[model samples]
Target: MNSPSLVATASITSPHRVGCQAGVQIGQACWELYCLEHGIYPDGVPYNDYGDGNLDPFFSETKEGRYVPRTLFVDLEPSVVDEVRHGVYRDLFRPDDLVTHTEDAANNFARGRYSVGQEVVRKVLNRIRKQAEACSGLQGFMFFHSFGGGTGSGFMSLLLEKVMEEFTSPSMLRFAVFPSPRMSTAVVEPYNAVLHASTTMEYDHCVFVFDNEATYNLCINKLHRAIAAIRVKKTVQFVEWCPTGFKLGINSGPPTVVPGGDLAKTNRAVCMLANTTAFREAWARVNLKFDLMYSKRAFVHWYAGEGLEEAELSEARENMAQLERDYEEVDGHDDDLMDNHEF
Candidate 1:
């Protein structure tokens, strides 16, 4: 039997674009407002507390009720540290919370100009592992990363890898808003990051992808665009879909082609259960369905072949069972009751 190469796994690592953080916050805030109006508590708080003027910022809980907005600085440029650390971006993060790629590390990668951004990513993964463990007891970590630009795409993938490596015991779920090639970035980095991330699906799962192009088409003017993009009328449901042992990362293109026909338009929602019997049941209950039809590859036609070895596929299936069981047990806990009812 042939081994399950990265190509085969890559097919399953499909990603959806969820527009920018502003859009996500708008969506969440709308949901929170709706819930508040109906006399129910909001689930996850939107990252932007001040307003939509700033890009989406990362927020962490202090184990106490306080929210600590942290800015993690990771990039191939040392100047980015200065930009984020002391410049206009300084207002975003807490003091002493910024993390960056070493000057030597970033310089080497920049000089070589590798497409992967592996070295800088390695540093980011290590730092995040430590930070995530320390903050694990808190209300989980939230990242407001953009799918556009080089640093956000590169660093987001790397940080995700490290979190998976360190946290095996029911790790905190990740929520990402992928940028549309037409809107988030006209550059090539997002296209590259999408392909790379897709190829490495064994590393992460349940990404909320969105496209800027779609949003742009929907909005008529800047004011309408701002309002429409940031204000989706729905409750921000924080669904924690654990990795379930089988990791799924997304990699696609700087110019990936969207699949043709209805498939081309549909936003594929994938629910991965760690190849186990228990997880199968959980997956059945979860019923993750793709509500929107968005193209997986937006423009670039980079195609990675698919096929997994029988043994690897079997193991993934087995893991799914345990994950399903774990999901029911943990997810079953009533967050609504706990939030409203005091001890």
Candidate 2:
């Protein structure tokens, strides 16, 4: 019952990369959990405090799995690479994981830079393909992106098409969040979003949608009702299994949820909520602010502009409330549909 490994890829330009940051957190958490599970005590703490962690990267293997950890980083900005390589998350990501495919996309839209984005992704995908060739039982893929920008939307959609085209059998899930309309992004976000919508619908087995506005409101006005604790039985698993990379699989757990840092904590929480019977009650404590750290925006003028009035903002709040209701209903329906079939 060992779950397949996950390959979490995010464009440097998009905020969705925040979710991909879990590689660091999960690795640490898993080490701690492993030490606690095993009889190891270093300075009275259960973690990788005892060994160099190089001779053996993993501490345990059971029905849950002990995947060999490796990452492939993809982005178009050299400056972004500098930040990641020399920044706070250096410990979470390895030097080899950074692909160094630089493409300037600050002032462009998805539709504007479609070709160049594809070229950059081609290089990164080649690297992922190499991983697929080398690794055994490498399950499916989980793509993280926001639909409101050029790289995340345009590049993400293209990557999905290519992934689906090359590896037809593996399942793909898109973890998508919306860009703020009046908050602080390009007005063309609407355009990038609409362009990405068709491709996303075409490729993804499931598109888990979240909105900045709704999450913000939940943390603000509904902190008491944020996403609650998840309830899963020992044998249950949410994601499927596949033989190919960038494809679908119903037999394995999502790699994003297992841990290291990008969205390790949040995805773990999400997987919990995704399986439980109490949808609304379980949706009681999802930390929006914590996840917001990955949401980097170059557009600050939107906040200063008068183009988005208070009336629009009020309506936006209402939309978010309605969206949550829709999510609860859909999530439950999805569970039922999946339960009827086992692949």
Candidate 3:
């Protein structure tokens, strides 16, 4: 028989590549699966979300295509919910009126009504529960909420916690697309509280966190208009790869933070799916912390000692420096510093 600790630690790893299907509720649904699959039952006791506590994601993909959305969680704002009730959610569901209940709930949540918030939360959870039940069982979920205004942050974390109560599969993964830091403050305050509560919540699972700040940093450092353009369904794969790749490394043994050029190259190799010459050239120049060498281009070039244009390499190194600065800033965090967990 398995020891108690082993049993507790037992968790699921995705056998195949994971993807986010964003036409609907992406955040809520994606996170559930990411946590469940990635969760590690170290010594048998299941760890909570946020790796330091419990459960580590397993499985790594060498190719960018490996990260795809299987489940999705649509983020409903009070206004959007109102629209849904009067419009979409109803038509999408069935039986009667088409009005957005989520928008109404958003108003209630922001007003900070304990009772109204609970009801709104409950209704949203119920919808998720019903959907999960319909699936018979789920693998992972995609979180599609904007990290802009207050409503998204106020309830996103709470929503995940509630979903975990009913959808207790193996590992629950949470993937989210947060807004840029400049845009997040209005929402981050509330998001901070939610994140704090979520970290402590027992039912909470691993979150595939996305930060608007992080995205912004990438865009600014890389001299790109928007991070999304390069991603175009490519960002999720990179994000998924980062954690899962790290997790897999740990499972195989343990991991140490990779550094210098290795880290940047690894991140670039995984982050960019388009094999454009520019992208390939870019990856060659940057260094990363965890050099799993999980990318084909990385390995091929690594072995061959490929060359990059001097100008391209120079710009890429600047981006790498920015990343290094940002990573260091957030790595040494405490509860007091929680407000700064950018990505």
RMSD of each: 18.0, 12.8, 21.0
Off by over 4 Å in 2: 12-68, 88-94, 110-113, 222-343
- CA error at residue 242 for candidate 1, angstroms: 21
Using lDDT as the yardstick, the better of models 1 and 3 is 1
Q: What is the lDDT of residue 151 in candidate 3?
A: 32
Query: TM-score ranking from best to worst?
Result: 2, 1, 3
Report the number of the highest-TM-score candidate. 2
Q: What lDDT tens digits, residue by residue, belong to model 3 across residues 1-343?
A: 0111000000011111122112133322323334344442212223444354322122221243132222222333333323333541232222211112343222112322222234456555555454444443345443433222223333444555555566554354443343332433222232222222333245435544445454555677655344445355332233333543222112432322222213332212224322111222122221421122222233223212322222332343455445445544444433344333232
lDDT of each: 0.35, 0.47, 0.32
Off by over 4 Å in 1: 1-71, 87-96, 102-116, 136-139, 169-181, 184-193, 221-343
Give the number of the best model, judged by lDDT: 2
> lDDT tens digits, residues 80-180, model 1?
34443564324434444444444322111111123435555555555555455444243333444444333444445545555566656332333344444
Model 2 residue 156 lDDT? 69
TM-scores across all candidates? 0.38, 0.52, 0.37
| lDDT by residue (tens digit), candidate 2, 1-343 | 2434445555523333332322222233443344444434422233444443321222222243322334455555555555556754454444666765545444244432455575676677786676666545656776655666666666666777777777757776666666553343454454345446644555658766656565676567644522122112222233344212122235343233323435544322322113233333222222132123213432323322412233432343344345456665644445455445222
Clashes of each: 55, 40, 75
The alpha-carbon lDDT assigned to residue 142 of candidate 3 equals: 36
